[model samples]
Target: MATISSTWRVFLLIILSLCPITLSATVVEDLKNLHPPPHFNSTILSNCLKNPSLRYCSSSPMMDFDEIFKFTIVASHLCNESKNPTCVETFPNVDLKNRPNIAPLYLSFDFFWKYCPLSIMSIDLSNNSMKGGFPTDVLYCTQIQSLDLSINAFSGDLPIQSFSPLTNLTFLNLSYNFFSEIKLSDSQFFKRFNSSSFLHSGALLDEKKFTLKAVILLVGFPILVILVVVCWVWLCFQRPDFLPRKLQRTRRFTPAILKAATAGFSNNNLVGMSDVVHIYKGILRDGTEVKIEMYWDDIPRDSYRRFVEECKVLSRLHHKNLVRVLGWCRSRKFRAIITEWTEEENVEMWLSRSGPSWNHRLKVLKGVVECMRYLQEEWPEVNYELKTNTILLSDYMEPLISRFKVGDQTSNRKKIYRFGVFLLEMIQNKKGQEEFDRSYGEFIKYITTLDPADLHKMIDHRMEVTETNFHQVKQVLSLGFMCIDQSNNERPSLATIFNIIARAYKVSLVLPSTNHRIFHGERFKGHMPVQIK
Candidate 1:
C-alpha cells in the first residue's frame, strides 16, 4: 500500500504537469485560458496612467480582461486578488451563468485596484494558509479605512509604510504569526493602541514587543547580570554613558559625480520613483554606474543608520538572486549607497517583461532564500524597508532589492517585517490595493497543495522552478516565517534561523513549518475557516 501510494503520487504529478502550460504568455493570454474572457487591447488605459490623480478608471464602465490588464500594468495602478474568505465553487452554478460577467484571476485583481485602491477599509486575512504579506508600497495607500490581518500565516509587522497612506485608518489589527516586534509610541498612529491590540494568545507578560536573543544579548546579554540591571535602570530611567554621541564628521560628496549620475536629475533619469525621496542615475568618471538617492532633512539620525546597515548587510551576501551592494557613504548633507547599475530592469519589470519562467523563478527563490539567510539580520533600530516592490532587479535578469532603507526611524524593525511581507507578495503577484480585497480566496487555494515549487509559481513568471528542489524551497519559506514570528523569541536568531532554514525539514527547532499539510496553527484563528474544505 505504501508503494501504491508513492506510485499514485507520481502518476498525479505527471498529469498535473500538463494542467496548464499557460504560465507562459502575456497575462492577457493567461487569462483567456483561465476564463475565456473577451479580448481587449493595451491602448485602452494609456490616458489614465499618465495622470493617476484622475480617478476616472475607478468608475469607468467595465471592460474585458486584456484591456484592464494593459491599463493596470501601464498605469502602475494597484489591484485586488480576491475578496471572499469562503471558497465558493462557481462552477456549474447559476452564479457562473454569465461567463462574461465572471472575472478572470488577473483581471479581478486588476479592476479591484482600479475601482477602490483605498476603499478597502477592513481586511481580516487571519489564519488562512496565505503564504505572504503586504506587497511593497501598499503601506502608503492612505485609503485603507480599517484592517485586521491577525493570526494568519502572515508574518511581519503592521506594514507601517502601508499605514503611511492609510492615515485615515481608524482600526488596525495585526496580532500573530511571526509579526515579532511592533513599536508603540506617542505619535498619532502610535498612540492609537496599547500592547493588547497587537499580541497573540501566549505572549510574554508585560512584554509589549518581542526581542530576539541576539537583541537581548547585544543590548544586555553581553553585560554582567549586575551591570545589566544597573544599565537597564540607568538607561530606562535616565540617560547613561552609552547615550548616543553626536558625531560631526566631515561627510564627503562629489557633486560632479552625482550630477553626471543623475543626468542632472532629468525626468527620464529620475531613478528614484517616489515623492518620498529623490533617486538619480549617476556615472563616476571611471564610467562606473551608480544610483544616488536624496532624502529631505529633519528625518532623524536613525534613518541614516538603516542606510548604512543595508549597505553593510548586502555587501556580505552574494548570490545570483540577491541584489549586489557595492558601497555606501554617509554625508552630513546626504546619505547614499552605490550599487551596480541595472539598466536592464527590476523583478517587477521582469514579471511584466517575460513573466519569468518557472525554472528561473525557483532559481530566484533559492537565491533569495540563500541570500536572506546569509545577509538578513534582525535590527530593531536599523534602517531599511523589505517589501516586494523594494526587491529590484538588474538588466541581466537577476533579482535584487532596492537600497534597503527607508528614511523612517521605524525602518529597521519594519524592514525585518517587510521581508515577511515580501514572501507573501511573491506567492501572489497582485498589486497592493487589489490584495486588500482579493488575497483571502487566492491564499486558501494557493496553500493547500504540497507541490514543492508552489512558491516559484506565484513569483514573476519569467523564471521557472523546473529544477524542483522541493526541500530547498520548502526550507527557505519555513525560514522566512521564523524570521517573521509575532513573538521575537519565536522568530529565530539570524544564525539559528538560517541554520534551521538550511536544514528545516531535516532538523526541527520550535519554528512553525508554515506548511499547510502540517497545520500547526503557526498563526491565529480568524483566517481558519469554520469548516475546513
Candidate 2:
C-alpha cells in the first residue's frame, strides 16, 4: 500500500508538469481565435507611438496574459519595443511611476481603462507629471487594492463620487499634486487613507487657510524682497564698513589722502594715461612712493565698475614681477588705484637711451615670461593691452607688469602676438607704433620678412654684439617670429616659449637645429629654424 501511494504521488507530479504545456496551447489558440485585423502588428506599433492617451506607453500589451504561455504572433507585436515603463504586464502589479519625459502609455488607449484588466491589483503612477482631473479610468479597475498618483502635476477637483467605485482600494497616495479641492459625495471613501497621503495637493485646506497663504505669497514676499535690497544698497553706499569684506587685505584710501599724495593732481604728478584712468606719481606720508591711477572725471558708470573689479584682482596678486597694488580711493567725484612705484622710466624710455646689455635684457625677458605664466595659469581672466611704455623697469631693472585691465577680451594668442611686437621693438631699439609707416601690422610685416643674413642690422647697435651673442639674439628673434605667426596653430604656447628662453640663456642647453618649423614658408626667410637642447 505504501508503494502504491508513492507511485501515485510521482504520477501526480508528472501530470502537473504536463498541465502547463496543455494550458499554454489552449491560451495561444484562444488569442489567435480573436482574428486580429489585417496589419494588426503595424496598427499596434502605430498606436504605441502616436496614440494620444498612451502615446509613450509600454511595449507590453495593455491586457495581461498568462505568464506561462507564449503569446500568439498577432498579440506578440502589440506595443513591442516600447521605451516606457510597463503599465500592464502578465503580473498583478502595475508600476508606471517617475515617467516624466512622456505621458503614461495606458493613457493612449481607452481600452486599457475601459477593459481594466482584472489581474491588475495595484497601480502606481506617481511623479509621472500626469496632469488632469483625477484619473476617472481607475474606477473601472475594481480589483485594484492600491493606487498611487503622488507628485504628479494633476490639477482640478478630486470628486469623491468618482472615487467611490474604487471600494477595494485599501492604500491610496495622492500627495504633491495640484488638486484644488475635494468635492465629497461622502468623506467615507477618504477615511481609508491617512490625511498625509494628500499632502501638498491643495485639497485638504479650507478656503480661509488657502486665502491666507495666497495673500502672504502674493503681497508679503515682494515687500520683504524690496526691504532686503534696500538694506543691501544702503550698506554698500552709506555704510560699506558694516558689510562683510571680500578683499580684507586691500586698504580703502580717502580722497583727501590721495589728493595730498599726488600734489592735488598737478601736471608733474601725471605720468601716463589709459582708456579711462590717468597714471600719477604720488608719495604717501610714510615716504612710500606709489603710482596713482585716477578715473577720468567723465568716466562712464560701467567703466567705474570695471575699475573696482580690476582693483579686487590686483589686490590678490603678490608677485615680484607684478607691481603691487597698494590701495584705492572712491568718492562722489574721485576714484583711484594706488600701486607701489617701481621706477620713473619704462621699457620704452630705457630702450630710447640705448637699452641694457644682452644678458640683462634676457633677465628682463625671463621675468616677463614668468609673469605671463603666473597670469595664464593662475588668473587667466586678467588681461592687459601690453605696450612698451606700460612695461615698467624697476630700480633693479627687473620687468614689472603694470597697467592691465581686469577683463580685457583680447585672446591670449593675440596677447602673445603683441608681446612679439614688443620684443621686436626692444630688439630694434625703436617704438613699433612710430616705425614701419606708422602701422603696427606693417611693423610686424617688416620684422617677419627680414633676411636671415641681414638680421644683425636690426639689432641695437649700442649693445656689445659678438658672434656668439648674435646667435643667441637670432634664437630670440626666431621665437619672436614664432609668436607673430598668423596661424594660431604655429605659435608656440607660453610654456614652450618660456622653456626655450630658459634654455637659450644657458649655453649648455643650446641644442642643434631640429625639424621644428619656426615659421611657415618663405615668409620667415626659410623656416627660421628653432634650436632647443
Candidate 3:
C-alpha cells in the first residue's frame, strides 16, 4: 500500500510539470481566436510572446489575454515590417501607413488602457488620410512626448480635456483637421503652440466664454441698434455730406459711360493686367487722360465691398508722392477706379536704360522714403507690397508710388523692412527678383561684416561712386542695413530714417518736431525741396 501511494505522488508531480506547457498553448490559441477568424495571422501571436513584460514571455502564469490580443493585432498592423525580436517590448514608436478605411480598423481607448498604460514616446501620423474624431486612445499615452496628427480628415469637436493626461507632451500638430471648436480649461498648455497648428481647422474658442458672449450679444442687440441710430442722427446733423458718404450712396455711374470712355474695353486700350484688376488708359468726356482699373465679374461680394471701402479711404488720402484717385464706378458685373494718368514709364523700365545716375537714384530714394513715412505715420492704412516696380516716374521725373492693396492693418515695422529690401535692390541694380531666392537673414549677416572700403561693391556699377559722395553712399547703406536689423525694435523709426538721409545729403528740409502728431489732419512737417539742375 505504501509503494502504490508513492507511485501515485510521482504521477501527480509529472502532471503538474506538463500543466505549464498546456496552459501556454491554450493562451496562444485564445490570442489567435480574439482576432477576426479569416483575417487572423499566426505571426501576431508570435510577436506578442516576444514582448519581455508580457506574461507569456515570463515564467509566471497567464493573466487576461483580451486586451493583449487587441494590442498585438493593432501593433502588428502598424509595424508589420519590423524584424526585431523585442519589437513589441515597449511599442515606443508607431507610424502606420495611410490606408483607406483605416478608422474601423483602429483600436479604441479600451485596448490602450489595458495594454499600453505607459512606454509610448512619439507618434507621427501626419498626412495619413485618417478620418473620424480625435482618438481618445491617444490620451492614454501619458509618457508620449511628441504627437503629429496634421493633414488628416478628423472631424467633430475636440475633446480638449483628453490632452490633460499628456503632461510630458512638448510638440503637437493639429493642423488641417475638421474640428469644429477647441475648449480648454488649461490655456497654459495651448500657449505652447503657434497659429499654424490651429490654422485650417475649425474656429477655436472656449465654449463657456463663447456661450456667454452669444447670450450677451443676443440680449444687447436692440440697445446696440438704438445707439447706432442715435450716433448716425448726430453725425448727419453735424455734417451734411457725412451720412451719404458713410452709407456709400453718394455716386453711381452707368456701365455704358465706362465702356464709351475705354472704347468698349478694347484690347488696344488695355494698359496693364494684374491678378486683381485690369488697368486701361481711358480718356474722359472732359478730354482728361485717366487710368481705369476694373475687377473681374466673378469676384465675390466681400471682395467688392473691400474694393469700395478701399476707394473711400483712397479718396481721402492726398500726398505729393501718391497717385491721386479721381472717381470710382460700380455696376452689376463691373467695378472700376479712376486715377489721373502719368506718361512716364515705371522705374523698372527706366532702370533698363543703363540704370539711373547716382543723383537720380538718391532723389528717387528720398521720394520713396517720404511716401513711406506719409503712409506709415499719417495714413491709417499700411502698405505691405512696396517695391521698386511699384514706383512710377512722372513726365517731370518725379516719383509716384502706386498700387496699394488693403490687408490686415499692420505696424510700420513691416513697411520699414520692405523699404530696406528695396534699398538693397536699388544698390544691387537688380530687380527685386532675387529677394526670395536666398535667405534675407543670411544676406544681412554677410553685409553686416563687410568694411566700408568694400561697401562700394554693393553699389550699382552704372552709378559712379567718387570720393565726394563715398561717405553719403556709405551712410545710406548703413541706414538701410539698420532698417533690416534682425530685431525690429533695434530698427530706427521713419522719422529718424528721414533725418539721417537728409543730414547725409546736406539737404535743408524742415524736420517734424519730435512730439508732432502726423495723423490729426496735420500736414507733413518735412518736404523735399525740388532740386534745380
Candidate 4:
C-alpha cells in the first residue's frame, strides 16, 4: 500500500507540469476567435460619406487646406468601419505629418488602435501636441516597419521592452519629450536608434550625472562667496591706511546751522582772509570750536567747483601735521569748508613776539619738512599755498599746517623754494612778506656775495648761541640755500630736505661751500637792522 501511494504522488506532479501549456493553447484559440480574418462589406469612401462626423466629411470640416486635402486622400484609402475594414489588409501607410490638431478631444484612439490594420507598416504623427505615455495599443499593429512620433509632449518611462516584440519595426522617432527614463532592457530597438531618437527625453542623463550637478550648485556657490570675502579682508589688512582714504565718508552741514555757528558771519568772527575765501572762528551747537572758510560770492561758478575739489582732497587726508576737515556746508548763495580750530597763534605772529632757541626752531622745521614730503610723494594734489602765516605753532611748539589752497597751482620746486625762504625768516627772526612777493631775488643776490666770516651779521642776536650750535646753524643755512636754487633741477627734493632737518643739531650736513655766504655787506656794515615786531 505504501509503494502504490508514492507512485500516485509522482503521477500527480507530472500532470501539474502540463497544465500551463494546455491553458496557453486555450488562450491562443480565444484570441483567434476574438479577431477573425479581415473582410470588407463596404468601400472606404462609402463609409466616410455615410458618416457625416467622420474625418474628411463635410460635416467635420478642417480649417487647414493641406490637412483637408490630406484627409481626403486618407479617407479614400483607409476605411473608418467599426470591424473588418477593407484597408486593414490592403493599406500599408498613413502620412499625418505636420498636423498640429490631428488628435481631437472626442475621437477615441483606443477604438482606432483596436482595429488598426496589421498590414499598416508606416505612420508619421510628428510635430503634433499629442501627449501621454507610450501608446500601448500601438503594439496591435505588429507589421509596422516605420513610425515617427517626434516633436510631441509625450512623457514617463519609455517601455523599450514592449517595443522589442515589434521585430519588424526598422525606423522609429521618439524625440523631444519629457520622459524620465528608459524602462527595462537596453534592447536591439535602442541599438538601432541613437540618442537623437530620445533627445531631451531624459534618457541620456544618468542618475550619477544629475546628482553631481546638484552637489556643485548647492556647495560650490557658498564657497565662491566666501573666497571673495576673504580676498577683500586680506586686502584691507595689507593696506589699512589706504583703504579708509579710498572709501572716506563726507559730512554735510545745512546752511542755517553754519550761519548760526558763525554768528551770521560778522567781521567780529572773522579770523583771516585768502585770495578766494574768508576764514571765520565759529562755535557749533555741540560747543565745538571750528574754523569755517567761506568762499567770496563774486564768482559763483568758480567757487562751487573749487569747493568740491577742496572737499575731495581734505576728506582723504589723515596726518598729524595736516589740518583735519570737520565737514562742509553748501547752497546757491555760499559754500564753506569747516575745519578743526587750533588755539595757538600762527608762526608769523609767534616769531615776531619772542626769540625761540635753535633747538625749538629745528623741531618745528622737522615737522614742516615731514609734512612737505608727505604731500609731495603721497598726495601731490594738495598744491599748498605754503606761507609762514599759514603754519601754526601748538602749545608744545609742534607745527600744524593749515588747509590746502583749493585752486593753487604751486609746483614741487616752488614749495622747496618757499621752505628755503621760511628757513631764512626763522634765522633772521622776521616775517618774509617781501620774500614771498618778489621771490627774494635781491636777498639771494646780496647773500651770494658776502664772505663766510661775516655770517654772524645775519644771525638773530636775541637767540643765545654757542660755538657748537653756530657750526650746526651754518650747515642748516647751506642746506636751505641748496633748496632755493634758481634751476628747478638743482632744487633739493623734500625727502633730501627732510633727512637734513630730522638730524638737525645732531649730525653735521656738508653742503656746497659756495652756499655759506651771509647777509653782511655795505648795507649792514656798522650794525644790524632793529628786529621787526
Error of 3 at 115 (Å): 99
Q: Give the per-residue lDDT of model 4 (tens digit) for 53-86.
A: 3322332343333333222222222332212233
**Clashes per prediction?**
55, 6, 0, 0
The digit string of per-residue lDDT tens for model 1 on 158-245 reads: 4454455566667766666555344455345656656655666222123423446556777775567878788766643333223343
Against the unseen true structure, what C-alpha lDDT does each candidate score? 0.45, 0.65, 0.61, 0.62
The C-alpha stretches of model 4 lying farther than 4 A from their native spots are 1-249, 263-278, 298-303, 406-409, 429-439, 505-533
Name model 3 segments beyond 4 Å from true: 1-252, 274-276, 300-302, 382-384, 429-446, 449-453, 506-533
lDDT of 4 at 278: 89
Model 2 agreement with the true structure over 223-323: per-residue lDDT tens digits? 99999999887656544544556723246676656777788878898898877778899887668888887885756789777777777877788788888
Supply the TM-score for candidate 1.
Answer: 0.34
Candidate 3 has its poorest 10 consecutive residues by lDDT at 524-533
Number of the predicted model whose TM-score against the real structure is largest: 2
Provide the TM-score for each candidate, comma-separated. Answer: 0.34, 0.46, 0.45, 0.45
lDDT of 3 by residue, 294-373 (tens): 87666688977887787777766787888877667777666888888886477767776768755677777777788878
List candidate 2 stretches off by more than 4 Å.
1-249, 263-279, 298-303, 429-435, 508-533
Model 1 regions more than 4 Å off: 1-251, 260-268, 272-276, 296-339, 376-384, 406-421, 429-533
- Between which residue pairs do clashes occur in model 3? none
